[model samples]
Target: MNTRLLAVAALSALLLGGCTDTSPGGQAVRARHEHFEELGKAMKEIDGQLKADTPTSATVRVAADKIAELAPRVKTWFPAGSGPQDGKRTDAKAEVWTRNADFGTAATRLEAAAVALKAAVEGGDAAMVRAAVKNVGAACKNCHDAFKTD
Candidate 1:
């Protein structure tokens, strides 16, 4: 009876382990998608403020800070097996993994742009903030053009 119970327990563990999504490709694809969604939301909020005749410094600061926080984390979401070739639904291009150094540089540039935008918002100068926002947008575009699929 005890032998039969042990065998059942072992079988259950093996079955459950197989059911888990332990693949790095699956996990990275999901994480990178969610991260991009969050970054988009923050960027949209900042853009809306920039479009206003009189943008609120406080709101812009908050949104810009969020982008700064998220930007540095962008590289971490694209580990090995996270590309389109992994059979996962990822917009990340194969070049992201192939040319990793370039991708890392792009991510670093984005973080710097975000940080600059945050500083501009704190300075409470709308024109400077606007310029900084444009820089941020350009940094994002550069990365997306190289590493992401439309």
Candidate 2:
């Protein structure tokens, strides 16, 4: 009877995990997670195209826009001011919570860089694309430097 009850409880949890609470914040975080995945995929595709000299500027623009959309969502994944935590599901360092404002600023700057990248690619301006990509990279590196470990 105890073993059966335990099995039933485990199954229940599996089903429950599929359904988020759907609160505004929950919705937001879900959106952010999905969008971030999309954005990362787009960036890799765009970078590959660029490096290969076969980029479709229009495609790059679309991808960059998608990434821009995800940039603001970066803050939703971490617990702000909650101290560094370690677990199976987090990519964030405790510094994200310890230095919440700085983390937020880094996220915001990434968004701005994405927007710039979108414009640059859409305009088919190589110089602008390079600059924007560099800016975006700097933002990523800065955030990683402050809040992540290998």
Candidate 1 per-residue C-alpha lDDT over 87-146 given as tens digits, one digit per residue, 9 for 90 to 100? 556678899989999999999999999989888888888888889989999999999999
lDDT of 2 by residue, 98-136 (tens): 778998888888888888887888788777787787788
Worst 10 residues of 1 by lDDT: 13-22
Could you estimate the TM-score for every candidate? 0.82, 0.69
User: Candidate 2: where are CA atoms >4 Å away?
Assistant: 1-35, 79-88
Per-model clash counts, in order, read: 0, 2
What is the C-alpha local distance difference test score of each model? 0.83, 0.69
RMSD of 2: 4.4
> TM-score of model 1 relative to the true fold?
0.82
